[model samples]
Target: MKKILVVGLFLIFACGSESKAQAPDAVKKTFQAKYPGENDPDWHQDDHGYFEAHFKIDGIKYRADFNADGSWVETETSIKKKDLPKAIKDVIKDKYGSEDISEIEKVDSASKGVFYDVEFKQKGKNKDVEFKADGTIIG
Candidate 1:
C-alpha cells in the first residue's frame, strides 16, 4: 500500500507540471510557423488572456504574443536608446531631460502597428511612453 501511494503521488505531480508547461497545440503550431527554427520558448498566459512566448534570437531577447485561437498579436524586442530614431531621441531629450531612461523596446503590434516603448524613472516611479517612428506620442 505504501509503495502504491508513493508512486501515485509522483505521477500526479509529474502530470501537473507537464500540463502547466505545455501550451495548446494550436498556439504551438502558430508560433512554429511564424518563427521557424526557434525552439524551447518559455510560455505563459498573460493577464489579457493571451499566450506569450519568450525567446531569444541572435542574442536579442524577444516576446511574441498570440491569442487562444492561435492568431498572432504582437512581437517586441528590446533596443538601445541610440537605436531610436533621431526624432524620437530629440523629443525624449527635450521632454524628459531630467529623467534617465531605464529601458527601451520596439513593439510591432497587429492593431497599433509599430512603435517604440520608452521607460523612464521619475520621482521613484516608472513611466512608460509610447512613440511612433516619427516622434509622435500615441500612448
Candidate 2:
C-alpha cells in the first residue's frame, strides 16, 4: 500500500544520511577544531563500519577512531619526551656512566608504579634495561 512505500523511502533516506554523517573528514575536523590543532587524519573503514584516524595535535600524537554511527571509538595517546620518568634517566646515568641513550620508554604499572625501559649501546654491546620508579633496577 501507499504507507509501505512511504516508509521504505524514509528508511532508505535515513540510512543514506547516516552513512554521510560518518565521513572521516567530519570526524577529523571535529577533533582538530575542539583541540585547536592541525588536522592529520588517516581513515580506514572496515566491515564493522569503523574508521580510524592517526593524527598529531600540539606536539602530541594520537590515534582516534569512530564507529559507523559517528560516535567516538577510542583514542590512544602517544608517548613523548616530557612523559618519560626521571627514574629511568637516573638509572641510565648510574649504570652506563653516560646519558647517551635512545628509545627511552616509561611504562605504568598498577602496583609497581612507573618503570623506564630503554635501549643503550655501549662497548660494542647493545643493552636493554628496565628500572623502577625510584631509580632501582627491576630487570
Best by TM-score: 1
- State TM-scores per candidate: 0.80, 0.37
Model 2 accuracy (lDDT, Cα)? 0.60
lDDT of each: 0.90, 0.60
Highest lDDT: give the candidate number. 1
- State the lDDT of candidate 2 residue by residue for 29-124, as single tens digits: 655554465544656564466665666666666655566445565555535445656765555556776645655655543345556667676677
Report the alpha-carbon TM-score of model 2 versus the true structure.
Answer: 0.37
Q: Where in model 2 is the C-alpha error above 4 Å? A: 1-58, 62-86, 109-113, 122-125
**Candidate 1: which stretches are off by over 4 Å?**
1-21
